[model samples]
Target: MAIPKSAERSEVGAHQGSGEIRLVDVTKKFGGSYAVQNINLTIPHGSYCCLLGPSGCGKTTILRMIAGHETPSSGEIFIGDQMMIGKRPVERGTAMMFQSYALFPHLTVLDNVAFYLKMRGVGKEERRQKAEEMLQRVQLDHLKDRMPGQLSGGQQQRVALARSLITNPKVLLLEEPLSALDEFLRLKMRGELKSLQNELGITFVHVTHTQPEAIALADMVVVMDTGRIDQADTANVIFDRPKTPYVARFMGGQNVLTGTVESLSGGLARLRNADGATFEAATGALEAKAGSPMSIAVRRDRIKLRKRLADQVLSAVNEISGIVDSTEYQGSYIKVTVDLGGGVFVVNVSDSEYFVDAVVRGDLVTASWTTADVHTLSKVDMGAIDDPYLDATQ
Candidate 1:
């Protein structure tokens, strides 16, 4: 099943420019409702891109469109400069691994992986050899004789991945491929997917509602709401500097603060919330006038919390006084939820720091963060407008 060294090199060289995918103003409509609207995106050749959102957000629809299972109502899809509107799945140079890892129950693992080749009328010996090589590549060659029903979830997933990859596709589409696995297996398979994509040098568009999964596996994370993209950027940029409030809250690990701008000073804007609690944020080129609405995000890990003393006075600037609503111990850190009069704020206290002086429920506390930890949010409405400050972990 081993490929010759020169042949492998030639195959690797041919991967260039083959995996790039572009969608321009692509919209899908069922009756009067839009599944996806004016979607414009480009997945770089050989990069891992994640389409992340909640249920009914159209992530799976986008994946299907790219796989040729669903057609856009308008606009265009291009895979390496070739239009994909009328192309069949096989002709589009893409393969899909569904969330269920669709495999024939009657077929053995090796036969399941070789099914596509069989459809193409390949010689049985050649298809079997190629399927064995693929199974070996995915480290599942030892279980090739087992039926799909006999394999574990992770094993079945690998078999499915091998089946899709054996087609020598330029792009691979995954629809929540890890949702069926338990937490432990999910983590294990997440690493395998990324490693496999890197080794094969093919574009991977994975759809998932899990925030951590998307951030961990994607080079580019596209956050969608309803049917439109809220923000699309690198994982770090998306998490550290989200473009909109929906994205900031959806990505978690951030406490969003909303207010009205009271004044603008030297590179700083002062804002006052409905409760009259004032805060300051570095306005980095944002044009804001008095009375304009504003919102800023502060990372939960960046805020420091302390139990408020009976007689100690608190500073109004860069600090919030609240009662500890709850605390949950995560392995490395403690998630502390503080009840501000109108809303809740969260802070991630390192276990070491929490053990030094931990505060419990009903304890009066003060949470403080520096201006440098604050990031201004764009006013652009990308849906999910009801409560921007709603704690994502909840």
Candidate 2:
């Protein structure tokens, strides 16, 4: 895709610099309650960062602060080298694409995209030409004359993206931009957003509550909780080795287990749950003692499940005997939920392997995983145990 001339021209501006963002000890309070507390983050220049969490976790609040829509109660925000606390949105060199699109219903797509340039006193013909170039960049030039109400959801989304890009922003803040689209459109637009960010080479800070969306699109995924950040890392690291139980549960592909340490030997800790179920996990560098609480996580796909013999005893380590609570066919894999007495554990079996000897609900099953698959989790206050925004179907 050709770079927009406006973006090229804006590169010469004195404020233009590498689009790195820094939030130092930022906090926001609303009537004695904290919305975000002590948030310190640095998004690298030209990276796609996602602030991921459930509703009211302060992801959007952070985005608004970055866009200059909301001021931090304390601390400082910087884009490149410029302080953003008291600057206007334009002065911050940022543009926001709202969740609702927020396009003018009465304006044509061209006029809507050109609105930013118009506000800056650009001539009508010049702004129209620049807007047309941006529309073509987003592949919506043909729809330039159409009203916002006349466009489809996906088309309207492109228009909004075009409008944001037309500003030639150093950082683009997206507040659930795909939340309104249907599943199909959301998937399609995800690729477009990534590609556009790459072509533009600008920092993209997206706020979302969906785990898959964050994992799929982000170079760095910052998992937020109630007024605090829980984890921030690459998608692979966040998924494969979550730092805390809250993140493991929120990411939805790991089963978290809690037990008391029975013994520590050879860099491995043997733990026993209240039910006397034995589990083993790598101690790594963490200090462990007898009778101390320990938490471990195992990926759902790493578990092996098989029918249990009537008299067969389960293993003392890395194994659990449970009854199948439910099974969901997910095309490539089958999601099996097993009731492990006081708790439920989820296992993902390939469809081919699952069909060989499929176990239905109510079946007696023993699920086991290798010790290498177990990951020690930090003992922290698990935030928002139940996320109302989590999509059950996802």
Candidate 3:
């Protein structure tokens, strides 16, 4: 059967306040293995949250359970004051915008947007007026008479958004909402989604596997690994101070370096690589035992490349010698990949800086950063943390 065109409707004032989502010890299991394991999260009322991970990392599973499409194997979900596990999705005060726009090909945009009200036994004139207001809100009123086949990808998406919002849901759930659009349309609609969410003053829980989409759209980003959350925090915290190696790597823009701790002195933990090149990072209050494996993340733009400083005295802290692996000329910045024996570092250089002293492949260079710039990362299970999106090509 085609997926249900409409969800059950709820009273408007019944869910007036911000839609706060609370998941308590939530788990979803398929057979003997868990698809989503013991997830406990609180999405603030009216906040924009993104569940970001690779395909099969359980982001969608969590979203489905929250939407009441699938019941959790264990634990409870609360949207506003209502327990959602046994309740119908509409009863939970949420409307989901599915990955596929799922618009009816035979219906005009007006009829499609009003289908939910129609199912609720609303008068034709009243529903049409309501749907018209929604279409105008999404800036698609001009296409109201067009069939789904007649509208563009962006237009169809607007129609979908209107249909979902017409329910007046307190929490709007989106599952891979932008995956259907082309690159240009996806970007344009991304901004619109955020703007709409703000204008409505409602919660938006978006599920996506794309990294940039999560970081750019979410006020709160929950980075997940296979069946587990690697990190969940505000966008700045998740991106700037990643809690684990997987987050640092998955979020992109940072280099993950692994080495054995050689010594600890003056609040700095010294780590040595395979070729004996060592670097120092601030240990803060965290315990660092000698010979234990430790990892650190340095932002791509934080690193500086130099021609070895051949004549000057040797360096202080956070410096490594490496051969230039390759250089990519990005419009605003150049990405220089350096091979440091056992690891690779990507240094992002401004366009002006790149043209001044462009280093090519095989050039001996020293990549240096600061102690304060380094962020320590907890060890992650390599088998679980490996990116499926990247693995597909390999």
Candidate 2 weakest ten by summed lDDT = 6-15
* Candidate 3 residue-wise lDDT, 275-301, digit = tens: 666778888767889988888888888
Clashing pairs in 1: none
Candidate 1 local distance difference test against the native? 0.87
Report the number of the highest-TM-score candidate. 2
User: What is the descending lDDT order?
Assistant: 2, 1, 3
lDDT for each residue of candidate 1 in 89-160, tens digit (9 for 90 to 100): 888889999999989999999999989889979899988888887788777889999999998998889899
How many pairs of residues collide in each model? Answer: 0, 0, 0
Better of 1 and 2 by TM-score: 2
Residue pairs in collision within model 3: none
RMSD of candidates 1 onward, in order? 3.0, 2.3, 4.8
Q: Estimate each model's TM-score.
A: 0.93, 0.95, 0.91
lDDT of each: 0.87, 0.88, 0.83
Report the lDDT tens digits of candidate 2 across residue range 298-334.
9999999999988997665888888999999899999
Best by lDDT: 2
